[model samples]
Target: MSLIKTEELVHDYIRRDEEGNEDGRIRAVDGVSLNVNRGEFIAILGSNGSGKSTLAKHLNAILFPTEGSVWVDGKNTMDPDEIWDIRETAGMVFQNPDNQIIAQVVEEDVGFGPENMGIPTKEIWERVEESLKAVGMWEYRKASPGRLSGGQKQRVSIAGVIAMHPKCIILDEPTAMLDPSGRREVIRAARALNDVEKVTIILITHYMDEVIYADRVFVMDKGRVALKGTPVEVFKHVEELKALHLDVPQVTLLAYELRKRGLDIPDGILHMEELIEVLEKICR
Candidate 1:
C-alpha cells in the first residue's frame, strides 16, 4: 500500500515587492505525482532549485499544495482537521540537526515528541529508549546534544522523530551538512530504521552514492520527475542523468566509460566489487 501519495501536486511561491505588492508567482513544484509504498526506501535526486525539497514539504504537510492533493497514510493534507494527524503520520527530518534538536540532553530530546503527544511518562521513556537504540544512540542517552558529534546529533534528531512512531520518515538532505563519515553514520541509521523497524523512508539528496542502495530513485528536473526506476534502472542512463545536471554512482560512471571504449561492461554497475567481478570475467 502507498504510505504517501501526491496527485498533480503544484506549489507556487508568490514573490512580493518591497511594499508587499504582489509581483509574480514562481512554481516550485509543478504537476508532481508519485506514490511511496509502505516499507520502501525511496530516494529523490536533483540539483538545487529543482523542487525536490518543495516536494518533500508537501509530504509532511509543511506546505499545502496550491493546485493538487497530498495524502499521508490515507489522511488528506488539505484537511485542516487532519493536519496534525498527517504530520504525526509522516515525520520530517531536515538538513540541519541543530534546528530539530530542542532539549539539551539526548534522552530528553528524543522524548519530547512523545511527550507532546500526551503519552504517559512511562510510555514516553519507553519510546525514548526504543528510538535511541534504534538509531544506535542509546549509549549516549545522557550526553548533551551540544557535546555530540555531527553524526551523533543527527542520529538523535532521527530518534526524536522515531519516538513519535511515524509510519514514514521524510529526510530532506539530512546529511548535506555532514562530513563523509557523518554522512555514512546518518544514512546507516536511516537504513536500519527501514530494515529493522520496517518504517518507510523518503530520502531527498543530491549525493549519487547515497541513492545506490535505495529500492527506487526519482530524479527531478524543472519541477517534474524526469526519471523514475530502480537504482540500477535509473543509473543505467548515465548520460541522461548527466544531462539533468546529476551524477550517477561512481562505479556506474566508470562502467559507462568502459562501455563507450568498446568494453563488455554492462550498464548501471553500482559497486566497485561488481565492476571488479565483471572485469575478472572478461579477463578469463
Candidate 2:
C-alpha cells in the first residue's frame, strides 16, 4: 500500500482583490498523480519553477490541492479534520535549516517535535537521543545549531522530524546551499534514514547524482509530472531531460559525450567509479 498517494492533483495560486474577488490565477501544480510506498526512497526532480516543491507541499498537507485529492497514509488531505494527522504522518524538511531550528541546543531542538505532540518528558528525551544518534549527531547534541555547519544543522532539522516518528519525510532541495561535502552528509543522512530507520523518503533535488540511488524518480515541469521512472530508466532519456532544461550528472554527461564520440560507453553513467569501470572495460 502507498504511504502517500495523489490522484489528478491540481494547485493554483489565485490573485485576490481587496473585495475578495479572484483576478488572475497561475497553475503551479497541474494534474499531478503519483504514489509513494512505505519504506521506499523516492526522488522528485525538476528545474526551478517546475512545480516540484508545490507538489511536495501536497504530501504534508501544507498546501491543499485546488482540484483533485491527496491521501497521506489513507487520510484525505482536503478533509479539514485530517490536516494535522496528515502532517504528522508525513514530516517536511525545507531548503533552509536555519529557519527551522529554534532551540539553542541540538538535543532540545530535536526534542521539540515530540514535545509538541505531548510525548512524556522521559519519552521525549529518549526520542531525542535516538533520533540524534540515527543522524550521527549524538556527539553534537549539546552544541548550539548556530555553531554547526550547514549540513550538521540540516541533520538536526531532520532529527527533529524523525523524533516525531513520521511515516514519511519530504525534503525540498534540502542541500541546495551546502558545499559538496555538506551535500554528501545530507544525502548520507537521508539514505540512512531510509535504510536504517526504514522511513519513507521523498527527496526533491536537482542533483542528478542524488537520484541514482532512489527507488524511483519523478520529474516535474510547469507544475505537472513530466517524467517518472527508476533512476536508470529516467536518466536513460537524456534528450528528454535536456529538453526539460535539466542536466545529467557530470560523470553521466561525460559518458554521454564519450558515447556521442562513438565509444562503447553506456547510457546514464551516474558516478565516477562507474565511468572509470566502463572505460577500463572498453580499453581492455
Clashes of each: 0, 0
lDDT for model 2: 0.91
Residue pairs that clash (backbone atoms under 3 angstroms), model 1: none
| Candidate 1 per-residue C-alpha lDDT over 215-279 given as tens digits, one digit per residue, 9 for 90 to 100 | 99999998999999999999988878888989988788889889999999887789999999999
lDDT of 2 by residue, 1-284 (tens): 78999999999999999999998999999998888999999998888899998898989988998999999999999899999999899999999988999999999999989989999999999999999998899999999899999999999999999999999999989999889988999999999999988999999998888889899999988888888988878888888899998977778788888999999998766779988999899989
lDDT of candidate 1 at residue 198, scale 0 to 100: 95
Off by over 4 Å in 1: 17-21
lDDT of candidates 1 onward, in order: 0.93, 0.91
TM-score of 1: 0.97
Estimated TM-score for each candidate:
0.97, 0.98
lDDT value for candidate 1? Answer: 0.93
Off by over 4 Å in 2: none
